[model samples]
Target: MMLAFILLPLGRMFGQQSPAMLATVAAMPDVQGAITLSLEVAMASAVIAAVFGTPLAYLLARSQFRGRALIEAIVDLPLAVPHTVAGIALLFVFGRNGPIGKIAGQLGISFWGTALGILVGMLFVSIPYMVNSAREGFASVDLRLEKAARTLGASPAQVFWQISLPLALRGILSGVVLTYARAIAEFGAVIVLAYYPETAPVKIYELFLSGGLQQSSAAAVLLLSVTLTTFIFFRYLAYGRAARKGRNQ
Candidate 1:
């Protein structure tokens, strides 16, 4: 926290020019495009991760199947690998020469340096957060409640929707937020796979390389501000809902 505060002022002092920095910001088409694309891809990636990951998380939570530990470890592989290595692995699967990418290309859907690439990068790095959080949430739910519902002749889907999901939604939401946050801040993988679309982190890196410290720091501050604001708002919303449910209970 102290380091963050220290960096903020130093970043501002070095980068915040009188008016030129503001003008540079306004005139930065690349930066603007990057920011827009980042948001779009991050949101899409988060949604996709949640949809696929939720069922997997549910299974992980409810069952003690063979290789359960292996599955869990596999889910966390992204966290263990270097970000750049993850990008390279994704490229092997999603590059133009890659089998999936080749098929996608025939269908006019490309991944490299496109919005799809951004989503893939975000998904690659951030999916573990959502899956793990949701699994934990589901695990916290009372198995007895589900059993009772089953005994009452509630359909599987009905029991899940009426009992399990409601009980685990907070955890799911927390995971979603963390995934989104991770996606938003992803740099190495995104830069390697989707440099053309240019997420905020890439833009900052470019500015530093091409322009200078002052230019890059300004962009960094802007990115930080946006991320911090969005996180705070979403966190408050999630916590408030949890609190309200607690009160009702």
Candidate 2:
């Protein structure tokens, strides 16, 4: 039943779109631009998630504070929030007139229809994936190994860098892949927050609305293929010999 359910749709989508149509959509300037922008912004968002989320994940995994559960819930809040509502919430907080936006405006940083806005929208929804993945990764590392290192006169920082980090790297890499994929697939929040600079998902949506299913299918197929390829490739890297590469590095 599961194979039938999944494979049917997959086969249908692949068989439906003509190569000529896919080529046409691929050649469209807007299509190219949207794909480029989505990849670029998604990469940037992954970097941001890594830098900002790593510490939070480490803290959550290692510490046991009174409000630890609450913090975890907060980190996962965006997953519960409707994405469009998430966009609206972001607008309220990051719009030109909003408090943070106003302060940023004074400092020459604007989140209005810019890459920064798109990034914020993606980050809001996708960060939990990275944080949770990384936390689990960190948690899976043996504490005894850390303690043993400590007894050997290694400081906490050294233990974390040399021991905990290396062992948990696969999990962290998984989080990064998921984070990038989530950011790329993002649409609802991005539509409201960064409509001007349309990502591939947004472009496909606009095409669907303005043109129709036939018109949208080509671009849709391209995006689906790209995302699926990336997912498959990253998963391969995360789970197999690629996992070893991260540790070696």
Candidate 3:
């Protein structure tokens, strides 16, 4: 009920938007670009996070090495850090004067004011979702299965690919979904690092500053509609997949 109170008013407000304003928002060319940029960065970030986070998650799940706790803490550090602080930290390391930026510059891969910058920021904040989910998934799988595969002449890589990966895929998919949501919703870090590309959130902020709540609200509603639709669709897809697997078994 309390949640309804908070959300109902906003829902009503969007529901009450004048058709002309809705049309204006829908017709804007940059709206398409903003959507494209948001999807592109979010998808890229999710892919990168899955690739890098999977290895770390696997280690965290399987290893008993010293400093494993420390590594886990470092992996989750972004959750504790403010987005602005994370942005600045990223900038310090990837900015023109920074070491990585110099290497990037040589390859003509600019970060500032580019899609790559948005991707980096998105990955920074969303990776924990992928890592944590994948780690838990890996942990849930019985080690005996992996050991049995190994005893059957499967190499380490083969054991992981055939046994661990398939069993852990559900959790990995969930992580990708969560990371995509997080990346799409990112505002502060992306604005600091790559504002010119104008993701949906940044565009909403810019509209609010330049126009007012009405214009900004229109964009906000659009973003909300798209995000909510995607979220619901994926949730249903995940549920359906689970149900199908259960029936097959």
Superposed model 2: Cα runs more than 4 Å off: 242-249
**Weakest lDDT window of 10 consecutive positions for candidate 3:** 234-243
Clash statistics: count for each candidate: 0, 0, 0
lDDT of 3 by residue, 133-169 (tens): 9998899889999999999999999988989988887
Q: Against the hidden reference, what TM-scores do the models get? A: 0.92, 0.94, 0.93
lDDT winner, 2 or 3: 2
lDDT (10s digit) by residue, model 1, range 18-51: 4678568746888777777777778787789889
Best-to-worst TM-score order? 2, 3, 1
RMSD of every prediction:
2.3, 2.1, 1.7
Model 2 lDDT-worst window of ten: 240-249
Kindly indicate the candidate among 2 and 3 with the higher TM-score: 2
Tens-digit per-residue lDDT, 1-102, candidate 2: 999998898778779988888888899999989888888889889889988998899999999999999999999999999999999999999999999999
Tell me model 1's lDDT, rounded to 2 decimals. 0.86
Q: What residue pairs are clashing in model 2? A: none
Clashing pairs in 1: none
User: After aligning candidate 3 to the native by TM-score, how far in Å is the CA of 104 from where it should be?
Assistant: 1.1
Query: Best candidate per TM-score, number?
Result: 2
Each model's C-alpha lDDT?
Answer: 0.86, 0.90, 0.87
